[model samples]
Target: MPNLYFCIPKNDAVYFDEHEVTHMKVMRIKEGEIIDATDGNGGKYKVIVKEIGKNEAHGNVLNYEFVAPTDGRLVLFAPSGRWERLRWTIEKAVELGVDEIYVFNNEHASRHYDDKQEKLELIVREASKQCVRYHFPSIRSIEFLDIFSIAPESTYILDFKGRKIPKRISKSVGIIAGPEGGFSKKEIKLLKERFKSVCLGKKILRFETAVILSTGIFAMKLGKI
Candidate 1:
């Protein structure tokens, strides 16, 4: 994949951040070279390096276009206890075309841990570049209750009783994955009330594994991926 660059929108031009410029310096990029850049809001541009400084980069937009997101928004809800696990799931989901990721604390989830929000953000940014995608996935932590309030076209919970997905889902959908200890009775009861409880298979799987496989399967069934 080509190295994807990012810049902030400024009228007709774009400017790179300190970290992004430093990365280009480390990569030994030179002026007058053409590169692909994204605004992280659907605009992808073909730019020519106009200038490179110690802490910034200036590029001239040669051409640009907006990229429509694939199919529809796919939101993944996962446990927020372990940063590594959360980051892994977030990265894979972003690469596989997830639009947003919501990490929330639940009844069975570990409540004692660092925020690690920076690490999660960095992971999604890097994954977007690596996958050569123009759309950026929004990543944030939320209360477990806020998740259920989202009005998606379809709602699915990762649980034991889920069978093969019956039909292709073509609208906005939410996938909820539980923590290592699984959901509490109240959580399960709530899930049953609001969404279809779905599963990957008979065999047990890790939280990280469950995320990517479920995303890929659903994306495919939706005639995407």
Candidate 2:
């Protein structure tokens, strides 16, 4: 089987940048080999390697296929907590087929996110390619309360004190995972009023854990898993 790779779509072309070329070299892929690649926007391609250079490669697009978006989407609302914790959550959530992930400000968070949009975007791309997903999950950072502006079609706030989440849920679900230290009392009051509260279990979970469980359960409920 040909190895799978990812590329940024340029008009009707896909260019393998330095990072991708390095992987190609590691895989011993050479000129004349056919490889599968995704544009991360529902477009997949079969390319025949035409030329290779020290830091880049060119391919001839032989064929293309378009995959439709997933039926269910999780517009996850999570705190901008520890980078590693947030990264894990993002990678797993993308692998599980989350449609979108958004980070929000948390007053009690261990550390706030910095201006690392470039790095964060790369992480999402890699996670999508790692799982061979048909579409790239959208990731964004929003001001604390701005999250409500684009609230889910069906919003469910994941909390420890809420009722158990129902097995069957709406196809388009939005999940709100609390901060590391849990939401502030004032924040909780706002959340309760904005969304329907739902619980994952009796025990308390970490910020990242809550994201995983909440998104996973909702995705499974929609049979998107």
User: Candidate 1 versus the native: TM-score?
Assistant: 0.90
Summarize candidate 1's per-residue lDDT along 80-152 as a digit string, tens digits.
Answer: 7765777678778887888888888788777623376676777788888888878888887777787878637
In candidate 2, the residue pairs with backbone N, CA or C atoms under 3 Å apart (3 or more residues apart, or in different chains) clash, namely none
Residue 149 of model 2, lDDT score = 88
Per lDDT, the best of the predicted structures is 2
**Residue-wise C-alpha lDDT for candidate 2, range 1-225, written one tens digit per residue:** 236788766666678988789879988998999989988889889998877798888787889999888786677776888888888888988877888888888677776555767677778888887888878888887767877787775888887788888767777888887777778888888888888888778897766677777787888887667
**Least accurate stretch of 10 residues (summed lDDT) in model 1?**
111-120
Model 2 poorest 10 in a row by lDDT: 1-10
List per-candidate RMSD values in Å.
Answer: 2.1, 2.2
- Candidate 2 whole-model C-alpha lDDT, 0 to 1: 0.80
Cα-based RMSD of candidate 1: 2.1
At residue 132, give the lDDT of candidate 2: 87
